[model samples]
Each structure stands twice: as structure tokens, then as C-alpha cells.
Target: MATHGQDPLLHSEVRQASTGGYFAGYAASIVLMLAALLVTQQHVLTYPAFLWVIFSLVVIALVAQAALFFGLGLSPAQAWKSVSLILTLPLFVFTIGLSVWMFHSLAPRVMPDTMPGMDMTQQPTLLE
Candidate 1:
């Protein structure tokens, strides 16, 4: 007679135990993410728009960690495992897009106009 250990599939009890560990890890990750968000918010004034990059990095890290450890169980064949990578790609793209848009929108206002020394007055003075 073959022992349970000889079986290729894991026993229910063992699987449950592994899943419990994953859950605990996931919970800890969430707590860390929240703490990071709070800290980022508090210091945002010092960094201005740069804070968004930090936030995006934290979010991406937390999501990846959770997915890898907790296994979303989206499919019997582990289709959920791919979700972390898929989600991360879009997040990076969005972050870059926001950063670029903000820079372009704000930079022009901060710098002098390209037509240097040109007066922008809408109406000329009576003496001129």
C-alpha cells in the first residue's frame, strides 16, 4: 500500500495549511501598503508631483506581492498567476502617461515664452 506522501496531488490538509500562510502574508502586505500611503501623504508637500511616482511604485509592489503569495485562484490551471504581470504593465503605462501630461501642462507656465523679450501686453499704452 502506498502512503499519502506518494501521491502526486497534495492532501487537502496540506493545501489548506499553505493557503493559510498565504493569507497571513497577504494581510501583512496590505497593512504595509496602507502605512506607506499614510507616510507618502504626509510628506507629499515636500516632493510635490513626485509623490505620485512613489505611490505608483508602492501600489505595484504590493499588488505583485499579494498575487504571487495569495494566488487569486482565477483558474484551475493557475490562470490567475499571470494577473500580476498583466496588471503591472498597465499601471506603469498609466503612471508614465500622467507624469508626462503633468510636466507638459505645467512646464510652459513656469518658463518664459520662447519669443524672448516680446511684450505680451494685450493693449498698448497711450504713450507707446
Candidate 2:
């Protein structure tokens, strides 16, 4: 029987490489998220739709970082982490979808019926 040192499945070099990659990916994700926040705060991307796109990209980056950090190996701990992430993916999608739907549904009810400085209604009609 091969010991851990000589085992085909677990190599010190591979573990080190995986750790380094995970750290690097996580650092990059943090930087990207911060940059996105700064851009939004500065009004560099003022449109709500564009901001949502940026948020989606950040979510994707976060998932990529998690996968890199947790899913690269077959050790028992890594396997558990990967399984948890896989199971949570659907929940994440559902939460985002439900939140967006609720926000859009409630916006008109909460907004004033007319614009502050104009005769026209603040609510836009499809034909307008």
C-alpha cells in the first residue's frame, strides 16, 4: 500500500498549487466587486439595468472563486463543500428571480402617480 507521500491521488505540489490558485481567484473577485461598487457609486454606470448587469457579473465571479477554492479536489472536505455549493445554486437563482419580480411589482404602487415637474404621469405606458 502506498503512503500519502507516494499516493497517486494526493500530491503536495498539487495541494500547494490548488491553494495558491484559490487564494488568487478569491483576491481577484474581491477587487472586482470593489471596483464595481465604486463605479456604481460614482455614477459611472448610472442606469439601473446596467447596474444589474454588473451585479450579475459579480455573482458569476463569486461563484467562480468559490469553485476554485472549494471544488478542485476529491478529499472528503472538498467533496462536501462542492456538494453544498451545487445544491445552493438553484436557491440562489430562485432568490434573485423572486427579489427582482417583487421589486418590479411593488415599484408602481410605491411611486407617486405623477411626475413632480410635469403634467404627464410618472408611470410610463407601453404605447408612450
lDDT of 2 by residue, 32-120 (tens): 88777777777655488766868787887876776665444556546766777778989999999999999887865565553355334
Query: Which pairs clash in the backbone of model 2?
Result: none
lDDT string, candidate 1, 18-125, tens digits: 666576667767776776677777764557565766677577666656455645455544555566667787998889999999988787655546435644463345
Q: What is the TM-score of each candidate against the true structure?
A: 0.40, 0.52
Clashes of each: 0, 0
Model 1 residue runs over 4 Å out of place are 1-19, 41-45, 48-53, 64-76, 79-88, 95-119, 122-128
Candidate that scores best on TM-score:
2
Cα lDDT listed for each candidate:
0.63, 0.69
Where does candidate 1 have its weakest 10-residue lDDT segment? Answer: 8-17
Worst 10 residues of 2 by lDDT: 112-121
Candidate 2: deviation at residue 101, Å? 1.4
